[model samples]
Target: MFSDSTITENETRRDLPAHLEQLLRTICFRIRVQGREALKNYSITAAQFDLLQRVYFNGPQTMTKLSQSLGIAKSTTSGLVTRLVRDGFLDRRRDETDRRVFTVAITPLGEQVIKSVIEMRVRYVEEVIKQIPEEKITLVHNALDILYEVMSPKQH
Candidate 1:
């Protein structure tokens, strides 16, 4: 996230607004806390969930690739993957041509875990949104839509 920020000599609030950053940070913190509670029911840790999501959405990746993509040390990812493999949430396969090279992929159980977690999150958010004023709720929803558009990568 910090890598995405661009610092300029003559910085203005528009360059990077503190209030906006604070609001986003607070929301992210609350959501993460709620996510942890939801994930606990499935016995999934944040790191595992993150790895599962990456493999799920972007296909299988080599140990090196996954480590680089996650910006974590390979040893750490290796241990995490080892646990996931032992827990039946991931499959670690050695390459046929290169026995030393291995790729990690999510197992069926991992998909189910991710699905269940998403369902839990949806229900949790639904419950929270129910308590918010209808008008304000719509405003936040629209804001997210706009934010996504602004943040999304443009086509070449």
Candidate 2:
């Protein structure tokens, strides 16, 4: 008998809602694996590097704002912030107006590194897109636009 895992064989046998779920799963897996491989020379994981880029672009941010923007828990955000600060990529300071509020900013070195990483990522994306046909690229762009419309958050 085959031992059951968290996702049972029966669950796997059942039809998925659409290919979208499988496609997304495959994309996530491939991207994560390849991204790690690409980041081997970097001291941080791809995700940590991505967080650093976000902070460089839009920081001097509070813990809550960072958490929200990064779609992570506040504790997780704090941990990331601590690690970045340790890496000399971030500076943490109390808000001048609010003693209770802590904010994080990217270091100058972090900005330069992040800019390079962003360029590398853009080049990688361009290379991937180069494999697709022009018509297909247009279709993909249109589909993404529709997807954005469908999935956009509703304003209160």
lDDT of each: 0.83, 0.76
Best by lDDT: 1
lDDT of 2 by residue, 1-156 (tens): 455466675676674545577887886675455544545555776667878878877868888888898899988888888888898888999989999999888898677666665565666668878999988998988987997898899887
Off by over 4 Å in 1: 1-16, 96-100
Which candidate leads in TM-score? 1
- Model 1 lDDT per residue over 3-45, tens place: 4356454565465678688889987777666656667766667
lDDT of 2 at 24: 70
User: How much RMSD separates candidate 1 from the native structure?
Assistant: 6.8
RMSD of each: 6.8, 6.4
lDDT against true structure, model 1: 0.83
Regions of model 2 farther than 4 Å from truth: 1-16, 32-38, 50-58, 63-80
Error at 106, model 1, angstroms? 0.3
In model 1, the Cα lDDT at residue 52 comes to 81
